[model samples]
Target: MTPKVSIIVPCFNHAKYLNECVESVRNQSYTNWECIIVDDGSTDDTEAVSRTLESDRIRYIHQENRGLSGARNTGIKNASGEYILPLDADDTLNPLALEKMIAVLDQDPDTLIVFSDTVTFGHTSKKSNLQEKFTLKELLLGNKLYCTSLFPKKYFDEGIVYDEKLRHGFEDWEFWIQLISTHRKQPITKIDYPVFNYRSHPETSMIKEITGNTDKKEFIYHAVYEKHKALFHEFFPSYISLLNRKTFYEKKLESIYSSKPYRIYNFLINLFR
Candidate 1:
């Protein structure tokens, strides 16, 4: 029988953590799940690790190195389950995640996407708490609803796939924005409970142009500010409200950096990290 959910995990050079990630899914309290592990041209022993899985519900797909977005697109194209979920190779889901998500989705037939709160863990401590529902505008401005969380399989049937051109980052955010722009009102439900753990190693690094330097951060700040300024105007065509939103962000930036010493310090430190 076809499973109720397909869990797609794309891996590339993550053999060290692949076993644990796959095992977590296999051990899920929700029984009706098919684990699809796409090994995106891993140079490590990822294949051998997956081979160790004994469950027939687990399937492995091998493909060339195609970045995260491309890998996820491939998984979406091949998935057979009614509900689809993307899980990072480095992260592990709580056993009850699928149970909760499926229950919620079953209750609300209109929900196009269902996501739960996440606990982001460093090699040492956990980061901030998970945020609740975020509007399309909020998602476009800042990505609080992380991508690895659950999404409906029908979402892919509309030919909505990740942009492979975005190799480095923000591809998921871009996809969500496109969905909102096209559908006008896509129901994205948020559960307050933690269902996933995002693993963070000490040497973790993002390839975004603005992540590592003060000058680049300034550039990103302006670039994003300008982009969001345009988006705000699009959402609120009225000049007065658009002007107020723009002014709010500008003043908010100044207040956060100047008045909030710890915030500025963290922002600066994030540049090097």
Candidate 2:
């Protein structure tokens, strides 16, 4: 029988965390799932480590280092299950996440995306962020969907593919916007439990993109802002008003040397650092 869900993990130079991610999925309380690890041309031992898994349910695909969006699209293309769960290489899902999410999907056939709260862990700290039912405006302004959330596989086939051109950030935000706009009526629900553990590390792509380097941040900042401004304004006009007081793009270009350029400089710096 076809697996009920397909877990697609995109890996790039994260050999250290890939095994733990796989172990989390393998230990899932639910059994009817397939794990697809798309090795996005990692110049590390990621591929070799994934090959060590002996389960027939595990399928490994290797591709050139396409950005996160490209790697996710590849996973969508190769998925054979009815549901798709995209997991970050450095993150792991709670053992009961699939079980709970699947139960919800079964109860409501019209649901498109189901997400859960996440426990974010760094050096010596762990904190939980409760997932709330979000409006398109909230999502466009700030993405709350953790990477391990469950989504309908067909939603991907019908909605927009990840914008591979966005090499650094906001591709997920863009794609989610497209989904919300096109399939505006589909229901999105949030499970109460912390079903995802987001590992915080110095070498994560998002961290490296925002903090350690500033050259591409301007592009990413405006790229994300421009893409969602319309939707964001539709729901939260106040934010747009605040933003228009001074063009973020202009400030970004002018303050190339300023310690912090964006209003949410802390977030922008952390996402790319």
Candidate 3:
């Protein structure tokens, strides 16, 4: 028997896209699945839109504004399927996504997570491929995994909820770090082709929070670093040393760039160019 997949769509002021998102799930080629629509206190018509779509396989849950992590946590808590797939309300998955990712996990008992490349739409149209292989070291530097990855329900069962405190952005990235580090570090599989469609828009919460606020971005990065400090020391001690050295040089360069002598030198160099 095929394992059932629970697709959690967490929505906040994204009612317009909810229909399309749920429809994509409904159209999945794989038959064993359920769609859980979680409305996170949207001032928009999210509740009404969600109410219209509830059915046997599709269920709706409403909560006061808890942000993305909180909304997802609620959905996960209510999900009954063996596998969990977090699909943002604004995004849609390919028809074969469930089928392929489920196959990967079913075949390999050692693999704990499965992700895929993404196709960007909405304001921008491009195919985003995974530039590097998935490794703990690479993942620490930056997040290559989308939030819509497939994984077992044991994460929730074992009390692993997405960190709701990370409201700024990269909450998913932080969650991934926590998921792999504290848990028994299992192998992850990434499908080569794109199985997810990401909608990129100016109003997107992540884009708005991360744009033009360098200080906030740094704060989030440092927060994640602090949260997973022990994991870093355990897995990539050398990389931690390199990061500290890089920070020292960056501070030194900032001082030099602000000095009158370095400014004069830079002006002269740019004049020649």
Candidate 4:
């Protein structure tokens, strides 16, 4: 029997892009799949848009605003598939993404996650060539696994859900660290070609995170480090000192950037860029 794949799309005021996102899933080369659209208290036309998409395979669920993590949790709770893929509202997957990823997991029982390269669109247009191999240390430094990756239902079964408290950003990065740390031996598959299309735009959460206040960003970084302090210290003890230095340097840079002289210099630099 072919295992069913559940594509959980958590939407919050992304009604404009919902149709294109869902259509990408519908046009997938693989057929045995379900697309669950979890609306997170959108004041827009998300409900009406989702209602039009109702079908045997495509289901829509609405809940109060709980942020991205909460919305994804709602979809996970209602999903009925052996494999899972978390597709964002504005992003999309390649036509053969499901078929290719499923094949890898089917052949290798030891594999825990299957991801692929991403092609950036919208504001930016380029193919991202990520590292082919997965390493716990490299992942600890930064997230290489896109959220659209496919994994078994065991993650949810093991009580692993996105950290809702990370409302600012880096929730997916923290989730990946948490998931991979527990199952250190299991290998992660990364396809060479692009299998996901990441839409980057001014209104995107990433831009908000990037342009956010430095102090708040630093706080989140510290919070994440503290949350997974044990894992970091255990696997890579050397990183602790490096993290401390990084925090210190960031503080110094923040102070410098805030100074009047630095502000004037930055303004001049931006003019040239």
Candidate 5:
């Protein structure tokens, strides 16, 4: 028998996109699944909308405003399946996502996690590499793995979960590190084309937080290193070198943008366009 997949959809103030999100789960070719929608203190019509969608296969759970990490933790704790897929409220999965990822998990005993490439929709159409393997160095540099992916619920039982303290963003990066560090030899596999659709809102708090808040960014960066310093110790020198280079390039770009000639060139180009 095929293993059951429990998709945990965490909804905040996104009542508008709830249907489309749930519809993606219903469309899954692999049908032995249940969707647990954790309404993280949504002030919108999330409850009413959830009520309309609820059935034996689908469930609704409400919690206080505990940010993304807390919401995901709640849904996961309540999940009742061998496999867990964390699907955000706004994003969606391709119909073949469950079928394809589950096949990978079943075929290989070493494989515990399965994810795929990302298809960005809404404002922009783009394909992003969500990383084909889990590497300590790669993840330490940046998070290529997205939040929505197929993982086992066993990890949660073993006490691997998202850190609620890093509330704003990049929580997944931290959590992924913890998950991968425990099982470094087992590489994370990516099936070629079963991509999840990542909805790019024209404006979002996450975008603003990442772009504007340097302090928070620095906090999470240091926090990850501090928490997993043992894993990153060998590559600390190289990581610092890369960080310094990135800072220098950023400053150089800022200078170019501030230059009068560059401004004039941009203005002229925009006017002509």
Candidate 6:
């Protein structure tokens, strides 16, 4: 028998989109898979929808509100597959996503993480923000992988799970960093195919919160940096230089915004528009 792949779908107040989300898993060309939907204290009809979809292969479990990371951990704990892939309730996968990803997993034992390019759809469509490859430095500096990436259950067995404290956002990035750090010998590979379907809706990305909220951004940054101090410490001088450069540019931009010419230019542009 082929190795079973467990698809963990964490749903919170996403009852409206639950049916289609589960259907995406059922549609997978890869048949040796199970879908586990974890409901995180949703007041909506998530239970009703999930119950209707439950079967021997697909399971449903309910938990009190534990946020996204908490719900993911819950589903992961109950998963019974050799591999795990997290799928958000609002998003989906292409028909060949599992068939393609599992082939790589079965062939490459050293490649611990497998990810594919994404196709953004819905209210708006755009190119994927991630690249096809990344070094440890680039991974530390920014997120190069999405939460839906397929990874082995061995990483979790090594006591690496999603950090529940990262309820604010960027939890996926933080988890990837730690996973790579712990299993430095293993590489994360990317398939050129765009098999993940990411929906762009009004809710947007929770990660956008970090872009606008300086305090929240700093909190997440500090938390991740503090947890993986060793990795940052190894590249201390270079990391600090990067921060200094960013600070300098931010201050320069602030100065430009406060300048009289910039104010006039902004006013003229707004007036013309």
Instruction: Report each candidate's C-alpha RMSD, comma-separated, in the order given.
Output: 6.2, 6.7, 4.4, 3.8, 3.0, 3.3
Give lDDT: candidate 1, residue 132: 65
Give the number of the best model, judged by lDDT: 6
lDDT of the candidates, in the order given: 0.75, 0.80, 0.85, 0.86, 0.86, 0.87
Candidate 2 lDDT tens digits, 64-167 = 98989889999889999999899998888888989999988999988878887788786535766645667766666556676667888887887567888788
For candidate 6, the 10 contiguous residues with the lowest summed lDDT are: 235-244
| Residue-by-residue lDDT tens digits, candidate 4, 1-273 | 333899999999989999999999999998999999999999999999999998889999999999888998899888888888999998988899898988898899778899888998998798888788867878877788888888888788788889999877778888888888888889898976577799988664663764466666666677788898887787768766887787799779989989999999989999999
Taking all chains together, each candidate's TM-score versus the true structure is 0.79, 0.81, 0.85, 0.87, 0.89, 0.89
Per-residue lDDT value at 86 in model 5: 92
Candidate 6 ranges with C-alpha deviation above 4 Å: 1-3, 238-241, 251-273
**Local accuracy of candidate 3 as per-residue lDDT tens digits, 144-257:** 788999888887789777999988878899888878766556878888756779998866556566845767867887788888888776766775576677768977998999
Question: Once model 6 is optimally superposed onto the true structure by TM-score, how far is the C-alpha of residue 228 displaced, in angstroms?
Answer: 0.9
lDDT string, candidate 5, 11-119, tens digits: 9999999999999999999899999999999999999999999988999999999999999999989988888899998898899899898888889957867888889
Residue-level error in angstroms, candidate 5, position 18 = 0.4
Clashes in model 5: which pairs?
Answer: none
lDDT of 6: 0.87
Off by over 4 Å in 4: 1-3, 236-241, 247-273
lDDT of 3: 0.85
For model 1, the superposed segments whose C-alpha errors exceed 4 Å read: 207-210, 213-233, 236-273
**lDDT-best of 3 and 5:** 5
Off by over 4 Å in 3: 1-3, 183-185, 235-273
lDDT of candidate 3 at residue 9, scale 0 to 100: 92
Judge candidate 3 at residue 215 and give its lDDT. Answer: 78
